[model samples]
Target: MKAFILDHYKKKGPLRFGDMSEPEVGDDDVLVQVHAAGLNLLDSKIRDGEFKPILPYRPPFILGHDMAGTVIRVGSNVRRFKLGDEIYARPRDGRIGTFAQLIAVNEADVALKPSNLSMEEAASIPLVALTAWQVLVEAAALKKGQKILIHAGSGGVGSFAIQLAKHLGATVATTTSTANIELVKSLGADVIIDYKKQDFETLLTGYDVVLNSLDGDTLQKSLNILKPGGKLISISGPPDPDFAREQGLNWFLRQLLRLLSLKIRRKARRHRVTYAFLFMRANGDQLSKIATLIEDGIIRPVMDKIFPFAAVNEALAYIETGRSRGKVVVKMR
Candidate 1:
């Protein structure tokens, strides 16, 4: 099979396209023929060795997180899906390799694709959509009539979150460039702060939740926007002790994370708001619900571009620019 292989971790290196043997499917896995795959900042970070301490994937591995394709075969235990089923997923962390001609995903991490979407669009949803779903619905438990501020509203996770927050009946506020003001508004953002012209901290207040997906400084600034007893959930972070524990890191790594996040955690406590660092996990059930929203037209994907499979490196470069309005995809079929 032809696949892009990361021979080694380099801060600015590109993946080498090569041939590798097909994957072995487990009893609880499904073998998928790749149709399209999504590009994410996480992919770049992993390639650059940023997640080495935690994720620890050795060199010479395929790299991709989001995918939409057809099930070529299903394991004996996979009763929910079978051959020819259209599916999409962010394969479980240790099992991800969607940037290839085929991948074997654990059945529990795969979901039927939204019937209303194309393979490229479906590929864009799993990672970003799941991030938003985990933050707003699962972690924050956001309620109607409340207000929430989602940073980087034009980005992948931000775009989905703004729409989902509005669907949940919460008033949504978001930060983006002036050029993307209308984009976020169309996604149902009640308040759009042009980051190039205005500061979000000055404009949003008394919010029930603040979803931060920006830099450390931006993460700190987000804490002020939330009201007392509000929640501050950061997907990009100085990982907190809780996240380290969730990943089951060793005592040294756990204490290191605790110390790294100490200042921000203290600040959150001082403001009487709770803080958590969310590292999204794969869940077939959550993706199924997200598929329902897409099929119902409650949430539509906001795509930036789709590159051919041969342009995988180019796709990753585009995402690194931090300029794409939404998700970037690679068509493999």
Candidate 2:
């Protein structure tokens, strides 16, 4: 198997492309012949070691998490799928190398790919779409007619959030630069704010939910536009105490997380709103539901660029520009 890897953490380190042995499957795992892998900011963060404490990866680790491929081998416990099933997953890290031509993942985290999607498009949805689904639908429970704001409206998660919120009958608002206003609108964002030219806080208010993917400053401001009993869900900084507890951080780290979240949470309480930091988990069942949505034409993948397997490092570099309108994909096979 050929893969891109880095042994040391460097912000600008290059991915070394070379040959490596393919992974072995466990009893509950399935081996996949990789077709396409999605690139995300999470990959860059992992490469830089920003998430080392909670989601540590061993040196010589394979960094890819999102993929779409065909099942080539099924372990004894993998009764849900069969050989040659087209599937997708955001595999738990350090288990499978989606950047390689083959991968093995727990059957619990593998879902059948939407039959209507191309391999490249299927690769783009798992991670970001699940993040949107878990945050808006499961965690926040955003209801019909409720107002919500999705920041970076043309990006990976934003594209999914816009459509999903609309699917649930929520009145969706979103922020993007002028160039992507129409793009966001087409994704069902009822109101589109040009982040560069307009202040969203002033342009809209009384939103029931705000999906904050921007900086800390933007997240704080997002709280201010909410009506009483509103909720703010962040995919950026400002970690939740529950998340820290789930990660089993030590006392000092837990305190640090609480301290960081204190002011914003207090402000949210003052306004009768709830605040939470969203960290999406990989679940094959949730991915299966999202796949059905795609097949039903309720949501669609928004791909910005596709790079050959050898150019994965370039794909990672391109997303760091913080201006990609949609997902960047790596064709692995």
Question: Quick one: best lDDT, which candidate?
Answer: 1
Show where candidate 1 strays beyond 4 Å.
Answer: none
Q: What's the lDDT of the predicted structure labeled candidate 2? A: 0.89
The candidate that achieves the highest TM-score relative to the unseen native structure: 1
Model 2 bad stretches (over 4 Å): 94-96
Candidate 1 colliding pairs? none
Cα lDDT of model 2 by residue, 1-333, tens digit: 888876788887887888788888899999999999999999888889888776777778677879999999999988999999999999975574678888899999989999999999999999998899999988889899899999999999999999999999999889999999889988988898988899998989888999999898998889889998888999987897988997788898899899989988888898899999988888999999999999999998999999999999889989999878889999865
RMSD in Å for all candidates: 0.6, 1.1
Shift of residue 26 alpha carbon in model 1, Å: 0.4
Kindly provide the TM-score of model 1 when superposed on the true structure, using C-alpha atoms: 0.99
Clashes of 2: 0
Give the CA lDDT, 0 to 100, for residue 111 in model 1.
Answer: 96
> Model 1: which ten-residue window has the lowest total lDDT?
199-208
Q: How close is candidate 2 to the true structure, as a TM-score?
A: 0.97
